[model samples]
Target: MSLPPKTALITVGATAPFPALISASLAPAFLSTLSSLGYTHLLIQHGLTPTNFGGTPSGQSLLSSLTNLSTTSPLKITAFDFTPNLSSEIATSDLIISHAGSGSILEALRHVKRLVVVPNEDLMDNHQKELAGELEAQGYLIEGRVDNLPEAIKKAERATFKHFPRSGSEVFGRIVEEELGFEAEG
Candidate 1:
C-alpha cells in the first residue's frame, strides 16, 4: 500500500459515563514510532470537542501535549481544539490513534485508515480497555499501554488492517442493533 510518509492520530473520550482512566499514556510512544518510521507529519489531539458537537480538559490536555510535542519534534504537528471536521482529517491521514470512543472510532473506520486505539481509562468505567482489546483481537485497532506502547505503535504503523471495510459495518451495525433492541446479523 502506498500510504503517506506521515500521519495524524486523534484520541477521543469514552461514551460510557464513568470517564476513562488516564492510566497509560500512549501518544508519546505513538509519535516516536511514527518518527522512527521516517514520517515527517504527525498530529495528535488528545481531548477534542463534543463528539457530534465540540472540548474538555482531557481533550485540552491531549491538544496541549500534541501541540507541545509538535513544537519540539522535527516534524510539524497539527492539533485540533476538538473534533474539527474529522472526515477530512482522517481521509488525508495515513494513521489515526484514538480512544474507544464510539464517535472517534467510527470516523476513523469510515476513512479506512489504520488506527491505534488507546482506551480511555479515566472517564469510562474500565470499558474502553475491553473495547480496545476486542478491536485488537478483530484486527481493527492497535491497543497498548505504557509497558509496550512503543512496540504497539510500531506494530500499528506496520500492520495492514485488511479488515478496514468490516470495521465500520460491524461496529455500526452492532451499535444500531443494540440501540434498537434487534439482533445484528453479520
Candidate 2:
C-alpha cells in the first residue's frame, strides 16, 4: 500500500508582503528538508503587490528565480499573489507554514492543520513575534524564524498540537451566561 501525498501550504497574508519568509521557505535546504519529510507539494501565497523598498525584489520575482532551481528535488512548487479561496487551500493541506498574522494563524488553526508560524521581525512594534511566542509556549503551534526554518520544520513534524477551539465556541457563551447570572435550561 502507498501512503497519501502530503502537501504543505505557505501563506504570507494579503496586506504586508513578507519577502524574507517567502525566500527562506524556497531555500534549497528548506525544500530538501520538506521533501525528506514527505511533503510532495508546496503552495505559496506570496502577496499581491511588490513592496516599495528600493531594490528589494517582489515575492513573485523571487519565486520566479528559484522556482526552476529545484529541479533536482521531488517537491512540486506552486505560488500565487492572493486568492479568495485560501481557506479551502488551508483545508486541503497537510502542513501550513504561515506569516504570523492573526487572521492567517486563526484560519489555519481553525482547520486543525499542522502549523509553523514565521513572524517577520521587520514589522513595526513586532507584535507578531509576541503572538507567535505565546502560541508556541501554549503548545498550539510552533514558532519559526526565517534563519532556522529547517530546524523548525523538523520540530513541528514530531510535535503534537493542542486543539484550538473553533469559532462560535461555547466557552465564551458559557462565560457570558455565568456573568449574567443566567440559569441553565436543564
Candidate 3:
C-alpha cells in the first residue's frame, strides 16, 4: 500500500498582508523546491496587512495572482486570505512555513509540526526576527529572510527539532496583571 503524500502549510500574518509577495516573489522558487522534495500539497493563508494589501483592489489582484500560481506548480496549491479555524489547518499539515508572528509560531509548535518561519521584514518594530532567531537557536524551527526561503526550507527538512514546551498561560496572565499593578480584591 502507498502512503499519503506530504503537505505543507504557509501563512503570512493578517497584520501585514503580503499575498503578493509570497505569490509573486517567493512561491515560484520555494514551491518548486518543495515539489522536488516530494511535497504534494501546499496551503497558504495570506492575512490582511493594511499597509500592503488591505482595503484596496490590490488585495484581490494579489489573491488572483496566487490562484493563478496554483495552476502552474507541480504541487497542488491552495491560497487564501484568511481562515477562522487556523488550529484545524495547522493540525492537518505535515510541515508549516509561516510568518514569524508569535501566534502562528505558537500554534505550529503546539502541534509539533516541522516548521520554517519566514519573517516579514517590512513592518515597523517587527519582533518576528528576534523571536524566530531565538526559536531557531533552540532547535525548534528554521528562520530565514523571504529572499532565501527555498534554502531555508531545505535546511529545516534536514535539521533536528526538539519538542516545544507547553506554555503556562496562568503564570503569563499573572505576570501581566502584576506589571499593570492590578490589585487582588479581597
* Number of the top-ranking candidate, with lDDT as the measure: 2
Model 2 TM-score on a 0 to 1 scale: 0.82
Assess each prediction's global lDDT (C-alpha) against the native: 0.59, 0.80, 0.72
Ranking by lDDT: 2, 3, 1
Q: For candidate 1, lDDT tens digit of each residue in 1-186?
A: 765567655555423321131213324554566677766775545453432221322354444544556567756776444464667777888777676666777778777788877665565356667666766777777886545656776898778774556446676556545544577566
Better of 2 and 3 by TM-score: 2
Q: Which ranges of candidate 3 are over 4 A from the true structure?
A: 1-3, 19-21, 24-26, 49-60, 168-186
Q: Give one digit per residue, the lDDT tens place, for model 3 in 64-134.
A: 65566667777887766789898899999988888877778878988999899877777665666766776
Residue 161 displacement in candidate 3 (angstroms) = 0.3
Whole-model lDDT for model 3 versus the true structure? Answer: 0.72
Ranked candidates (TM-score, high to low) = 2, 3, 1
* Clashes within 3 Å, all models in order: 15, 0, 2
lDDT of 2 by residue, 1-186 (tens): 966899999999999878788777767788889989989988888894353312223334554544455565688888788898999999999999999887888888889888999988989877778778877887878999998999999999999998887752464344335434578778
lDDT of 1: 0.59
Model 2: number of backbone collisions = 0
For candidate 3, what is the total of clashing residue pairs? 2
